[model samples]
Target: MSKLLKDYLAKSLQDKKDRGLYNEIQILDGANGPMIQIEGQELVNLSSNNYLGLATDDRLIKASQTAADQYGVGAGAVRTINGTQRIHQELEEAIAKFKGTEAAIAFQSGFNCNMGAISAVMDKNDAILSDELNHASIIDGCRLSGAKIIRIKHSDMADLRAKAKEASESGLYNKIMYITDGVFSMDGDVAKLPEIVEIAKEFDLITYVDDAHGSGVMGQGAGTVKHFGLAKEIDFQIGTLSKAIGVVGGYVAGSKDLIDWLKVAARPFLFSTSLTPSDAAAAKEAITIMTQSTELNEKLWQNAAYLKEKLAALGFNTGHSETPITPVIVGDENLTQKFTKRLYEEGVYAKSIVFPTVPLGTGRLRNMPTAAHTQAMLDQAVDAYEKVGRELGII
Candidate 1:
């Protein structure tokens, strides 16, 4: 390696370690479920995005296997170039129906979906009003679009209205769009969609919602947009199949014209290989299950409520989360890492999130209580938290 490159790498890695911003990725020996094995130690997992525990569902697994057997392993090429399979169309149709949209288009992943979709529509001649705490993908997509990006305060409807009005009235851009996470991932607070819709109507701003963490967990499994009856109000509805759907990929559900445009213009769909046959089939089946039953969603809410109540009773600052994501803010980055290490020692695999994922000095242990986790498992995790919190003086 070049000496300059090696020195830069060494300095950067050391800086992260010194600042306690370095995260060590753990390898799961088995499937990601309510519980996981790390380095031979079995621990209750509270760090997955699989909100419905569908990642390990028998039905999805069987669907995946069947598709693999019938369609082979991969789609073989880009969607526009002979890779669009019958299963892909079916999955998009299921997504469209689930989202109550006239049409939908599948993508390789949620990040890629954002990257392609945003840039496909907006450009330097336009402006985007984005929530400050939106996912990195949204931020990158907005940047890639070359749109003048204006950041809005997190869920502050007044701030959003002001910004939307400012941008729309400025007469500096051809198009003005507003984008936010349907459900904020880090703190679990939901977007104020009703007020946003009202403001958008007043300003005539195009709307986009990234519901990565809300799908299958909100609106009896439809999504946040559906939860508030804003399906027809919002212009763009985005969801990740990898989240509650327990599969791997993403989709954008919208009017047939929007989808038709995306099919021809989205760079990722036009260039990247299509989602594998097994993944597409499994995702479609997962959506079907979510549509058929609310049992899993109910259980997920129940477990989350129970976990949040227990954690609060134990004196941990869980913030204002409206969903199943429970974040125990530890304030200091190194201390948060130490707290999670203690939890791991006590048989809980709660991970620490810090720095770029959130603001500095707000390091936290982000716990995900899924539908698959039983009260018994939750109790066990809380027991571990209690022990660790007391030992670490966090309680």
Candidate 2:
């Protein structure tokens, strides 16, 4: 490397270290489940987004293996080329049927689905009203769209209304689109889509809901839009096959015309190779299971309620989470990190969310309760939390 390049990186890394902002990645030695092994320690894991515990489900694994054996591995080309297979078509149809849309299109990831879809629909002539706490992917997608973005307060319907009215009356743009997450991952709060849809109708605004975290966890495994019973009204319903689906990829479900347009206009689907056959097969199986039964979803909510109630009873402030995600709020960053470290040492693997990821003083330990976790596992985790809170004087 050039001396200047090396020197620059060194200085930046050193700065992060000095400010305790550097993140160190851990190596998972096995499959990600309720319990995981990292560096010879077995811990009760509460840090995964696998809400339904389908990642290691035997049915998904068998489906993936069957597909791999028949189709080999990679797609070998982009979706526009020879890459789009029968399985891809099946998955798209499944997603549309599941999401209650006319059609659907898949992308390489949830991130790029946002990147490609937002840019394809809204351009420099358009304005996007985005929630302030939408995911980073949405922010990047909005930036790429070249549209004038107006930030609405997080889940504040009144602010959304005021902004929508202002943007519409100003006549500064030809098209107005409102984009937000169905569930905010950090705080685990569900979006107010009913109010959003109402406002959209009044202003003729196009609505987009990125339900990445809500895909298999809400609406009997459909999503948040369906949960609110507004599937027909929302314009773009985006989701991930990775999170709750326990595979890998993203998709946008919408009208046939919109999906047709995206297939041609979205750059990622045109340029990037499609998902490997195994991943696609696994995702298809996951959706099949999700649609067929509510057992997993029911169990997930039960576990979430149990953990949330236990933590609250123990005096940890789990800020307004309406979903399975539980954040144990610890205001100080250093204290939060130390608390996580103690939890890890005591056999629970919850991680700390400090400055920048969250507002500086609102550091937290984000806990994800999956359906695979038994009551015993949860009790053990609570015990660890109790012990650590007392030791740290946090409770």
Candidate 3:
């Protein structure tokens, strides 16, 4: 590396260490579940996004194994070449049915789906009005699209309307789209999809909702778009199988024509190999479980409510969260990191998210209470919180 690059990196590392901003990574030695083994120590885990505990489900495992035995591992070529298996088409159909859409297209990852889908639809002449606090993938997607990105204040319908009007009146673009996350991952706040749909109708703009954290958590596990009863209205409904589905891949659910267009135009879909047969089968099984029974979802909400109530009663600021994703707000970045470290030492594995992930000073220890967490496990976690809170003077 050049001296200048070396010097810059060294300075950055030093600054982070001096300010206690650098967080140490922990090795998870076992399966990631409500309880996990880290460095030979078992801990109550509150850092996973496996909302329904389907990641370790026996049915999913069987499905994956069955598919692997039949099709073997890996897709030999990209979709346009020959990688699209029968399982791929079946999975896409399953996703469409689950999301209540006419058709769907899958990608290698949620990030790639965003990157490919956005650029395939919009261009430099078009403009995009995006939620200020949308996920990084959305921001990157907007950039890749070459659209004139206009930021709207988070959850502010009025700001969105104003920007939509401005962009519409300019007449410099052929179309405009309003995009937002169905559930804000950081704050756990649900998007105002109804209001957004209304605004889109008024402005004749395409509507996009990235339901990465919303799928299998809302609308009886259908997702936030269906939660708001706007299934057919929204143009783009994006989701990730890595989270709720307990598998890996991302998908965009929309009209038949849109899916057809994306299948041909989206670079990732055209160039990258399709999802492994095992992953596709596992995801299909997950969707089946979610649709057939609400047992896991019910357990997840019960646990979420229990934890939120206890945290509130204990005097920690659990921000404006309406979902299972909870944030124990400890403002200072240094304190947040220290707090997470202490929690780990106390046999609870929750990670601290600081600046860049969230705004500076909004540093928080984000907790995700999954359905797999037993009452006994939660009790132990609560006790740990109390002990750590007192020691750190946070409560």
Candidate 4:
């Protein structure tokens, strides 16, 4: 429209292209499953966040349809308004039970859950010790909180302890909080929660864990905190229902007091419309499925292990990942893009992670292998990877 706005947009686009940071998005023609149809080509899917394949489970679909029939498609208003429906309350209760927490409160999405939860509890007078490799939402949330944020090196307990000690003894802040991703989405590394809990107790610092990528993939589906048996130690446990829960929404699980506070103080919960009845019902059913059996979880791990071993044998450097989130670290940005293209051409759909998403010079293909992927699917993906890796000389 305006000359200045047009110039800025043009320069930004040109810069991204010149730097090989701009990614052309591909549209999926059908369901996001183990095999996906993109641009009329069927490919073995390895980029979805559906770790347990519950997104297309018949049970969750039935629950969603039943709730949609019983209730309207939408919540109609914010929770404080007329949106605190029975289904919504039931979903929260199910989340609390799944997370092994005293209570829980739901949000429209995981990104805002961090945004709202952090700002609601911490203030400018408080200091938050955060992991350097945390999700962007956590970083934005800390900024929104107006808290003095001290970054700790990725999973470095020494740095965390030192920062916590300095902030605690400074006598400059009334409260200090420690926050991290239970399972980092990029590096796929698990946070050192046990050592963190010890550090939190040592400094009397508040603890928060956003397990957005770990809910259905870790701790036997309870999450990373419960996986480490530290449920009672962490003050706040946040997660997303869209990824592993196979629905759509976010939540914070903690004490009854914490849930009550979020209900009153979190701006998103107060302003944004509540989740649809179908989503709430489906999410609850997904949680129920995870709790009743570990079948999906076990299958997911098996697939992850099988794929990782295959990729390693093929000579692709998978940077330290403990979860199902596999990364093929292809150092250069252009090379990363080229590798992704090769994989896509060979019938695998894995995306490239580059500058702004991951640090510069660390561009990679972030693979997400889920429970729905059969041995044959994984084998097919591995065959594609082998062809691409040898062609690129990345092996």
- What RMSD does each model have against the real structure? 0.7, 1.0, 1.0, 0.7
lDDT of 2 by residue, 217-294 (tens): 889779999999999999999999899999889999999999999999999889899999899999999999999999
Report how far off residue 226 is in candidate 4 (Å). Answer: 0.7
Task: List candidate 3 stretches off by more than 4 Å.
Answer: none
Q: What lDDT score is found at residue 315 in candidate 2?
A: 96
Using all chains and alpha carbons, the TM-scores for the candidates as numbered come to 0.99, 0.98, 0.98, 0.99
lDDT for each residue of candidate 4 in 1-395, tens digit (9 for 90 to 100): 99999999999999998898999999989988889999899999999999999988999999999999999899899999899899999999999988999999999999989999999999999999999989999999999999999999989999998889999999999999999999999889999999999999999999999999989988999999989999999999999999988888999999999999999999989999999999999999999999999999999999999999999888889989999999999999999999999999999999999989899999999999999999999999999888889888898
Please provide, for model 3 over 257-332, each residue's C-alpha lDDT reduced to its tens digit, 9 standing for 90 to 100.
9999999999989888889999999999999999899899889999999999998899999999999999999999
Candidate 2 clashes between residue pairs 3 or more apart in a chain or in different chains: none
Angstrom error at residue 231, model 2: 0.4
Which residue pairs does candidate 3 place in steric collision? none
> Which residue window of length 10 is worst by lDDT in model 4?
386-395
How many Å off is the CA of 210 in candidate 3? 0.3
Give the higher-TM-score candidate: 2 or 4. Answer: 4
